[model samples]
Target: MSRVAIIGGGVIGGGWAARFLLNGWDVAVFDPAPDAARKIASVLDNASRSLPGIYDRALPAKGKLTFHDTIAAAVEGADWVQESVSERLDLKHAVYAEIVPALREGGFIASSTSGFKAVDLGAKGASVVVVHPFNPVYLLPLVELSGPADLRLRAEPVVRALGMYPLQMEVEIDAFIANRFQEAVWREALWMVRDGIATTGQIDAAIHMGFGLRWAQMGLFETYRIAGGEAGMASYLEQFGPSLSWPWSRLTDVPDLDDALVATIAAQSDKQAAGRSVPELERLRDDNLVAILRGLRQQGSGAGEVILAHEATLPEGGEIDGLPVTASRCVPVTWTDYNGHMNEAAYLELGSWATDGLMRIVGAGPDYIAAGKSFFTVDSRIRYLDEVQCGERLSVTTQVIAAEGKKMRLFHRIMTGDGLVATIETLLLHTDLTTRRSCPPEPEVAAALTRLARAHDGRIAEGCGGAVGERP
Candidate 1:
């Protein structure tokens, strides 16, 4: 229960606040604009919808939130302070001066500075660390930390406690990790357009349809390593190292921002974005990130690891409150078959989604699966009660049916928006993470199963465990 103070309430600051608050840290915020409250409200609205949708278990009760009229009041009891005021050095310096005296000695202060160096900012303080977090702070796991060597050890765990994976830079570098990598691409893209090598859309297409897919999963070095075959990283570097000297673009040089080039890029970007507003694009981006990351969580790879790490922190089965609800999506066209209905495989997919939700409730999830244990389907009895056609919306409700020793049974129903039952079923399981055998659940896990079982003890469907047709 550390108290976190978010010093500004713009998009980035509000995202930081959402991440900390949802993770169970009390948060206080200070923002001077009269519309600050409204702005943060909008940001949190999106966050509330987006954050909890990524997982099935409930988010920890959001830590209490308070708004402070002054900087001192906000930082008064804060154990960690995140300064996300405007990037101008003068503003940052003023904020540091205002809050420094109130910050407890050894209490951490991090500047979400995308470019400014902590040492160069010259803000005199007891301790300071540069914690450069990207936009959409709540979802992105990467945070690059740089400061004096001694301060890093103190900062790393604080970052981890906030549920971020911190990459400590041995030598402080400009813009840290992801941003620097982004800047390199940006510089090259600009050069390409300026030199008439490619249209704006073409460059984006090349990346998004090409290297971007590979980079998303494996990243630059590892991707190249895979390409190296049996030779490994050293061999890959040796073969490609010569190309580095013959580069078509200069990493160190800044591209000229000529009016003609700027207009061409801007017009192309406008076309690329269509008519979507900034907020619309932001929402779209978040939705895609959530869907992609959630899928990865199931596979136990990629950015899904962040979701998996979070799953480990959840309590086992119990009454959970304040979990945010996400928007529902229609079954994708790809899921439909020649018969114009969701294919048989997609039925199992929906059932798997239901299982993911149930597992989260019972404290078995990605991390647990990663640890070499998980609930695997031992038996299933599904009935297609009614027809569900392509493009139709679907929702499912899950209930624990029975629990005894290592085995438990779960029942679920898939329904249309109008409450027509399209499908119904029971799934029986003996979870086995290792050897993939039918093994009994661990005591803690069994206890969770038993509690869920008792909650719905008498409410079982017909043909399910002899508890006929009675549904809760």
Candidate 2:
């Protein structure tokens, strides 16, 4: 198994440990802090509950996590070392000094520094790349990588394997890319607070309730492109470019974070928290992010594409109780409802995908559909058996009831660790996409389906042949 050593055990460090461990990398950590293990454990628990739901496929089994007393003990056989110590040049250098010699052959180190130049970091001549991740590292995919070209090249694929996107910085700069923009926004937000222009809650509302939502999906330029109307980005710039030079006063000035300002900000932030602990807030943030990402997944846009792309790489197909396992996935936040369970419509969506899965199993996959033939659902009956909650993994196993000529029937069992949760019985007709009429499938596909039907003959599916509420 691949191994990673984590230095420090603060928020960022703990997040890194959780990221690596969930991706199935054995993690060794060294931190003298007494609560380090507890902190990492808490992060791991939060991560475990949320991260997998963002994907339609299962992540690999979690890895072993061990804490060590000395840095060397953790670093000795590691394939990669992630340093997330406090943002002190001397402290970082000291950690690097101990890490370099202890690294196994071909091992490298990545610093989770929010902002620090590569030259300054490698001044002591130990090669390290800046791989900065946003908070709640397990979910956010962006990681800014800066260092020598060779070092970055080596790190990029590893990050991608963990389902993260690596942003390569060819030119090293202060604070890297994301934080620079953030610093500008923060400076402006602070000025607004100092000038009493807006309170913390109002500023937050401005973000999540407006531009922040826009930014989350289309981002600045693309969203502006819409504002450009019939024209594109060029028209957008022409219209708004001149306004940027206006006296957007106080940007050049710094806010005085004195006692009053700090107290004002602190009190407002407390109100914003509204009695939810930091961990509770993190859970809320994670749920909203999952919903947004899954929304994007439907359009194959933004971070959803990353997840979709990664899911394509996940292995599929298995059997359960003599039936073919057709669909397996974590219930996304979008799939839940006010009832605190999977929505009724969401269950139909699950059954639809399971039908698709069964198609692939019987020689009717993407290529077959692309060749102008596919199954069209004609009827479906679903019996809801139990509750399915957000983040719960659900698997659908299909038992073919009939497969003759242009008609096929399927009974799907939806299961969780708690046992069978739902059952769907569906009927489908093979169709000619061009003719838009019922038709025979390809010879091979027909034969395969027939064989499957024969194999499943004489088996009893409890809810098979039942209309809704018949209780068959």
Candidate 3:
């Protein structure tokens, strides 16, 4: 879709805008709050690093964002409207009323309300879908989808197009999917504090030290299935089922919000989270999640696998300019090492830089590089055809040897002078940024490659001799 309108430009709305814009969908933001622009800009900055880190490839061009003074103007010609207003029912009703008058009949509306059921909002519009996403929306894949089944069916592909998973809730329920899970854990933790059986630190330690790690890759049921050992989930469930009658859990009981209990929990939580500001904690979380998910992606498992598949559908290098160089970097001073020559890795780095420059030429640039879609080196055959002392000027040239769907054969030559060919030849594959797996370039990108391939057709890469196929 060409344009998406986001209402209530708070954190969730801003995040939604980032995801869509990164995927090449133009966005318009509508919020009466004067600070909406600043909030969205911050969201985009965070996403620039976080989103790109997950994928080995580059994303599509970020779409143009417009700030509309009125809701009507924002909704006009919008293919989708994402609402992220306050959680109160009255506020949502008012926002919905304001939104509906401006929205076209077929335009899709997704509410970012955590607890509100889609049915409540659907009465106002036939095409409304409740799409509640977790915090750090660009990185997190889970999005709860509930509403008219038909509306959800229509909305799922759009959600997928933005590199997110649309989880369908079988029935409309308050708190939807994740919040219900959160409430259950919250209740148990509160009761532990009321009884003085477990400190907040103890509870947090228990989770982060154990289940949290498992949960990152496998959900509760899958984890239990493994714990079942030889028999599987059924055998484990049958063995554990008999213990259900025991008073093992006080999960249903309510804890009074007493001052002493609150203080104890709060103090313990503060101690457990000591020495880290919210932003620092967020960075730590992002780092850990990226590392873990990236590992899983390499293994072709868990959420990493799902994200990998989502990225596969993204365009490799479209008609705009060039293939995005996801691995581009300037030569680092440290890369010179002890020798006067650039380190071997640094040669690879320069080659990557040249490839990126070529990508910009084909059309993909910073904006397209943000969406988790781009190209990756499958194999490289570099020949140190010539080596000169460090501190000399250097550059690289890239040519498309062959382009067929997701696989493109690239030949790169690094040179110290315009006439000399220093190093060359890299075979590449179009990859989904999320999955880090090979995928065919999108049709538009492929078409552009056909032209690029022809332009670079009959030429052989300058240096393709010495032990050429080694990875840097």
Q: TM-scores for all candidates?
A: 0.75, 0.94, 0.72
Model 3, residue 284: distance off in Å is: 1.8
- Please provide, for model 2 over 1-472, each residue's C-alpha lDDT reduced to its tens digit, 9 standing for 90 to 100: 8999999988998988988888899999999999999999998988887788888777777899999999999998888889999999999999999999898876667999988887789899888899999988988888999988898999998888888889999999989989998888889999999999999999889888999888877777789999998898889999998999998856778898999999999999999999999888988998888878777777888888887887787767789988898998888778888988899999899899898898998889899999899999999999999999887888899998999899999999999988999999899999999999999889999988999899999998897886668763
Q: Cα RMSD (Å) per model?
A: 6.7, 2.0, 10.0
Clashing pairs in 2: none
Residue 369, model 3: lDDT of 60
Worst 10 residues of 1 by lDDT: 318-327
Best by TM-score: 2
List per-prediction Cα lDDT, in the order shown.
Answer: 0.74, 0.89, 0.74
Tens digits of per-residue lDDT, candidate 3, 1-472, equal 4899888888899889888887788999989898889989978866665665565445666789899998889888898889888888778777777778778876667889899888786665545789999888877888899988888888888888777788988798888878988888989989987888988888888889999889988999999999899899999989898898889778778888889888888788788778787767766676566667667767767778766887676544322123232232223233455775567776776677667766666555555567666878777766665554433444455678888877777776555444453555677677777888877776767777788899766665444433635434
Report the error of model 3 at residue 60, Å.
Answer: 0.3
lDDT by residue (1-472, candidate 1, tens digit) is 7799999988889889888887788989999988888887777766665666565455666788889999999999898899999989888888888888888866757888888887865556535688888778877767888887777777788777655778888887778778878999999888888888998889989997899878766788899998777999898888888888896676788788988888989998899899999899887777666666667777877767766786666543322122211113345444567886667777767777777777766777677778777777766766655566644556666667777766666766666657645334555566565576777776777888788777666663544543434443
Instruction: Give me the runs in candidate 2 sitting further than 4 Å from their true place.
Output: 466-472
Off by over 4 Å in 3: 124-127, 317-472
RMSD of 3: 10.0
